[model samples]
Target: MRYTSAIGVTTAITAGLTACGGPASNGDGAQESGGGASGTIEAGLSYPLSTGFDPMITSGATPYAANMHIFEGLVDLDPATLVARPALATGMPKKINATTYRATLREGATFHDGSAVTADDVVFSFERVLDAKNASLMAQFVPFLDTVKAVDTSTVEFRLKYAFALFPSRISVVRIVPKKIVGADAKAFDAKPVGSGPYRFVSAVREDKIVMEKYEKYNGPHPAKAQKMVWHLMSDPSARVSALQSGRVQAIEDVPYIDMKGFTGKNKVESVQSFGLLFLMFNCKDKRFADKRVRQALHYALDTEKLIKTALLGNAEPATGYVPATHPDYSKAATVYTHDVAKAKKLLADAGVKDLSFTLMLTDTGWVKDIAPLIKESWAAAGIDAKLDIAQSPAQYAKVDKGTFDVLAAPGDPSVFGNDADLLLRWFYYGFWPEKRYGWTGSSAYKKTRSLLDRAASAADENKRKELWSQVTDLVAEEAALYPVLHRKLPTAWTTDTLTGFEPLPTTGLSFVDVGRA
Candidate 1:
């Protein structure tokens, strides 16, 4: 990562009361980033596999905060404001055509190396994601972009195949990576990064920690107050919590599901709710999975109630729908799966399946390890012996796109999912992961799901959109393409209440931007 600094604003929104209970747009253009998060606080982040601190390979919840130091987009969504405002771009995208748009470059923006942030830089960044050679994780994030071109020094345009209502939100996530940000010649830049954000990269000590200092050029209202922020890589959630207790660190993240209760306001420990879904994704085109009965059986075999009780310890809400069971559009009809071994067996037998077996890819980090074992046990309890196929993340995610695996045990964080099912549908049922039903197995069921996604993404009416999503959700649950497990509250168990600003988000990983220590 090339260490660079440039002054720019991520969307700053006006705060409103509606955002209190959950994630909502802030009505105020600029509000206090909350509490006195102006000091250094050692924080913990459980990165998804292989997300090497590099934007291209990086995954999970880091980009919103971590990547803010290395790179940023022309605009960012102020979760509170819910407005897509200028960060890298000077303002909102300039709509140039029915299927195309343009964005003006920010004024006086320069990278850490002091190079001007030009239209070429923006185009280069977009090209990096589109280049199939790089195999960037961001590819899955924006599978629909047909192409991106820099029209001039001050303008960049996007040509899309379809009109995405949340196109701006999608743009909000593509952090601007300086040219040569990755690959063989990327050594120098990777060691340090240059970006137009509020922070500057100071040092990255391998797997131990990455440090950054606040940018003096920052013009935003709530500039980073701390002298420096540090992210320590800790694997064991308990180990991380102990560090917090011992004062080795101010905060720890990816709190174990069972560990949530240990935190309370008495200790100044707060548990915020995040938009995340634990699910069992099935590759529909695979021969073993061609049988809907087999897929449906996989869904029925899970003892989610016991999994939450014994494994999750009330840390999560047993998933019953397509999106997080808590999302506004989630439907009751979507919450279909329950532990019915008889039903699972019947489904399997009906599909003429016996001596059934499949590989469950997992990872050491994230829910793959903790929850995978429970799921494996749950599956075993139903007499389906499954093998564990584990890989280092976010690379493991790449396999999902190819449609190579049988069953994928993963969670859909809203950060990646957006506020809608757009990303989910793209990566799962409707898109090409494992295999698209575009071929032999392709059927009306596939069309129905894809149509739901298309309608959901294009819907202009909010109420109608909500109803459409409810139907989309119920349809997926009924199909059991990807078994939705539970909705989770952001879990953070700490040793003390020294740090603040740990609002539960719709994504994964940990961040230090709005977090400060007493």
Candidate 2:
């Protein structure tokens, strides 16, 4: 696909997975532009458009980033700090009773369409998300919420099914949208989103690019600094680098680990440790993996240090616990697996496994592909025969979700939704993956893990909650149904001289909230 620049010159963008090199071009075209400083900001992302802009169900990288600009929740998370602060609400929601809370809307707030943002809009937003038929990915996060209703024109109240201590942080999962527009045509609304945010949706070309112009009437704490923003969906890593080098784009994300040192001077690069993890998941229904000993054995066999150093080029840190050490609430799990082939072999033998064999399914993520061979080699050393089946995330998960695979090695960053322990842990264990996908929900261990997680979620005492969370972490680590191997750092590159206030995020996607072109 090609992009037509402001002057009607078409710049060809290469559209396949290929080696990273200089930016693609058909001849001399527009180059070296910064969005925040002088003109429209042109940015590049490594992934293409996968989902829509609806905050309740959207999970794609490109769409999620667009939602960051096009929508605002009651309590919004700072893209950099991951801290929850007031956005649409006047301040943090006040706890009225054990199971009820109230928040007042900011005065003079209006949607991009110039319609007033009322308590009804907020109620509709949460109702749609909480509705089970909608299958909202966010519904799982707010299990405690029973109903949201308008108290008056500006005030809104929430009644929880049970007391939830992390209600403030959990409420950040869904962004408020206009009821009239969305209720008219949900599909059309997804394509053309309307929100009270820094930027308003202009157009989207699917896997090519998405455009957003500044919402002139935005009255939020963070207003649009740039007049316009163009997000180029370049799945090819080389294209992203080339766009950065040619100045076609001022900033780019998911910088290739091998090219980190090549950036210099005006082009600055930074890699922040993120909760994004490469995890190993087992199909617990399979007899070979039913025994906890066998699962622990496989984890012990892998030389994770060697794998990270060689395949990841030392860009990742081993998962010391379920959550990365960078997480504020990090806990050290009881059973920490290090490279010990003898221990792995012993565990396998003790489980009455003479010759272990399994098919290892993995996603086609570039980094995972590089690490796949090392995984097979490590398992082979422990006398386990492993076969690899590599495919995209959706395809791989489809097979895993169907109970067709023996093991899965994939990279997932649920931190994009919310960075708290309860949300992060529940993502894999509480609702879907453990029970329906991994077949572990029927087990006693899975039940215990769920109990501990729920106990942690509702605990009023912070210390007691931490202790329960730690217990859950230790049980999951010992069971080894689905656990992280390493928490990788996210590397983002930008022209320091041009783009100001642009900070790299620990989660997925880039933030241009306070950014301005220098």
Candidate 3:
């Protein structure tokens, strides 16, 4: 497959992957000449276009990253820092009462289609996510939201069921979308998104590349610095490194740990401590795992420290709590899963379990694949027989959603959406994950977790909210029904000579909002 632009630049898209490495061109025949703010910024992305561009339901890491450039919430988070700031809105929403808040859109803000962004667009955005039938992935994040109404063409009002102290930062979960485009054909809008953002969506091919151009009409705070961006979807870590080293692209994300030292002086490589994690989940409905002791046993059996050293090349930290230590709200869990083979065996024996054997389903992510063998070995040493089932994320999740899986070890980082403790914990524990995927909703532990999260969400006092969150973290940690195994570092590589204002993100994907080619 090939894409030829109006400017006569032809991009060859190979089957299952795109070709990497060539001189960086400004989508024209000539190479980028000067360190001006107006050239093409090519990047090597570590994930393919697995999901759509719609902010409401898009869950894939790649698309979520793209949306950071292509859309704006009333408030948006700084990609480099997780700090929330006004984007589409003139400023942060102003509180009117205990449960009411209001915001005025930025004057003259226009969508990618050149339509003036109105309060109605903001209302539509929240309504769709709030509507249960849409099944928006963001619905779980804003459970406190009751209604969103347009006060006028510029002003919008929000009524929350309860006073959520984190409401200002939390609302960043829902990105504002053009109502006319989405309401006309949601499926079409999902594929080709249009938003009032700095960068306009140009084109995307599933396994090839995603292209975006600077939205000239954008009146946002962070306007696009580059004229265009070409994100080559290179899932292979080696390919990503090669693209950066060869100067085919200015930056590359998910740099392999083994190749970090090689890029030392030639390119800047930094590994940021991210909330991203590899988690172990159990089918609590299964009689064998219905016992909390069995779940605890499985968690205790793993040699996490050794796994980090061997599989991750010491790039990850063993899970001490639900969130990583870097998180502001992080608290040490009551029961941290340290390696204890004897304790594991005792717990299994206490449950009267003998010859425990099950299929351990895990994703085929680069790092997770490296850790799989060690997982099986650790379980085997604890007198447990385990079968390894490694597959792509979609396939593995298909079985998990259908309740056909025994156990799963997969990478999850809801911090891509928002980094709040309530938001992160509720992502897996409160909603679809516990109720549908892991089958923990029926348990007493699940009920208690729900209660705790609800109370914490409504707590107006910051200290009280943190106290409540700590209790919930301790509860989830001890249960081990579905909990993190380790929080890994996210490594990114970029060249200073070719790009300016590039910062490695502490989250999953790379960001280029204010970045420009040098």
Candidate 4:
């Protein structure tokens, strides 16, 4: 998709908000102002454009947030509720057999380039993702997927390697892309994506902003309700809050926990329970964290309740298991680590380790940054010295993936793909995140966990799958190589007077799929 007009503005709207104590437009032209009866919707995103918008491999916060509007999978996650709903597909795929399924595409669905979205595009999308050379992050989720083929003009068939029950839901990993446009220039396509969604890709500035306008020719269940959208990449928490307060942006995400109560009247704030969690991953290769007992000791030492109340402002719940208590498939793990300083000391003593000193690597996410000191304090109380090495997620993850860090404390939410136990479990344990990333594959525990997860995925019976999942959960909890400390509630602030159909997402980032300016 080709776009014109380079509208530039300052980083933040500080002056206008300082002049007036309430919501008032900064009048920074169309560049920063948005959301009236017939105005563009400017959203203050909490992340910069770190990764380019390639649907298959894009994982960066800003790019992934933008792709939610610019592309649609055969099945798409509902913005408000993360439930899988039909997007490009006419409806949910029909199960033909244990290994085969068919999806009928919605007719007249065209890419932003005005080319018809054919079954060929669907087949190509999945094939590209399935190809090993592309290094798609979605490849691991579809290990069961044997092949995808275009049976007809409007129908696509999926052949699984085994009997996988979550086939319908798992297909959302691959978003459909135009074959001609992408095939011609893959690099250019990544920079500027073209897909059949409500919003068309206009232009994107690396760390400044991303611009998109409603695709008038779009035909889908959740069509764009606004004329245009501009996502201001405000990585700073104060800048985001200022943008919303100044009326320079209609909505803002990652609302600070302390500031939630101050939002009143026309400025609304809501903290929706999200599957997003502050996870702790240990490098199994490190002799220090190699012992499961030491890992368990560290978890037991953490005062999770205190952390949530003080660090997170009670906008989170201690992780009981892999899935939160709110989840439908929630199962309390057999091993529950409930803050016991005495138990932690005893475990460390039993393991024959004294005064543990290790460097803790963390990302620069605002909430995570807030909780980092608390974590160190918890460790200090437990007679452990944890030196902090704070850096951005990409940099921190580079250290994590290379086994350069002792322990990694970062935030992740894969529930946007699917909320199922298998999908959620596989995200950390099954993919490159486990083997190449954290070096957890060497252990017999990893082998057993993988075996149990595989059996669970293939098990036809729901009860059997649950049992297998629980078994894997117990084993992982016992291993303690990686686990969640708490599942956080995503806080979002929006102007109630100017935006309609605006809802806080249970996942990270905001969605304007069906939202409009009042």
Q: Top TM-score: which candidate number?
A: 3
Give the per-residue lDDT digits (tens) of candidate 4, residues 1-518.
00000001012211111111222332332432323224578899887665667878776666677888999999988877778888899899999999999999998999998999999999999999999888777887899999899999899999999999888888987899999999999877877788899888877767677778778778888877776787887888888998899889989999999888888899999999988888898888888877889999999999999889998899999988888889877888889989999999999999899989999998877888889999999989989899999987656765665568899888888887678899899888875667876678878888888899999999999999999999988888788889999999999999998888899998878898788878
TM-score of each candidate structure, all chains considered together: 0.78, 0.93, 0.94, 0.92
lDDT of each: 0.61, 0.84, 0.85, 0.82
Model 4 TM-score on a 0 to 1 scale: 0.92
Cα deviation in Å at residue 127, candidate 3?
Answer: 0.9
lDDT of 3 at 346: 98
lDDT of 4 at 395: 69
Best by lDDT: 3
What does candidate 1's lDDT look like per residue over 100-187, in tens digits? 8889887777665566777887888777877877766566667658888888787898998776666766777577766644433553
User: Mind sharing the TM-score for model 2?
Assistant: 0.93
Q: How close is candidate 3 to the true structure, as a TM-score?
A: 0.94
Q: Candidate 4: which pairs clash?
A: none
Q: Measured by C-alpha RMSD in angstroms, how accurate is candidate 2?
A: 6.6
